[model samples]
Target: EPEVTQTPSHQVTQMGQEVILRCVPISNHLYFYWYRQILGQKVEFLVSFYNNEISEKSEIFDDQFSVERPDGSNFTLKIRSTKLEDSAMYFCASTKTGNIGYTFGSGTRLTVV
Candidate 1:
């Protein structure tokens, strides 16, 4: 019955600007993740966090991207500089364990102009 929550459902930013997307996963979950889907493309994993550290990250999570649980409650993704290619729907997800299903947030639509 628990759920993940994402804020600012949509965001528009200028290219080269910075943006931070926020999410609060199910309180008791142990693993949290950030994924993104470029319009009409498959969803891609960006990073996975556990125990306050990054457990896994995809190639897409380059030097410009970072994730942190600044308050041990809200998980955030920061893009150092926005790019037109970065426009996509970002999703936050969490699960009690890897074998279990994940609860995903509605998604944050980021648009770079």
Candidate 2:
């Protein structure tokens, strides 16, 4: 079966630096989403994109964060300014239907020092 893939499984950056997390979502899917898990915290939705525009984004998706579909299969998240609190496992997910369960990439671990 096809699966989502994320590059640089782990990333370490200094606070205030910019970071880009890359993900290649599953082909043939129409909806994509980004979520983050802060250590022991619950998975929080950052943003959902469809039809090349943002469908929904939580409060956490502030000016510091942005999502883009630079290519057919690639979805990327750019953090303009990293913070120590930004450390988390960022997961990329996709689904054929927005309401259905999603298939998530292993995740990219961001560690802002």
Count clashing residue pairs per candidate: 0, 0
Model 2, 91: alpha-carbon shift in Å?
A: 0.4
Q: Put down candidate 2 lDDT per residue, 52-92, tens digits, no spaces.
A: 99999999999999999997889999999999999999999
CA RMSD (A), model 2: 0.7
Worst 10 residues of 2 by lDDT: 93-102
- Model 1 weakest lDDT span, ten residues long: 95-104
Per-candidate Cα RMSD to the true structure, in Å, reads 0.7, 0.7
**lDDT digits (tens) for residues 12-96 of candidate 1:** 9999999999999999998999999999999999999999999999999999999999998999999999999999999999999
Clashes by residue pair, model 1: none
Q: Candidate 2, overall lDDT?
A: 0.95
Error of 1 at 93 (Å): 0.2
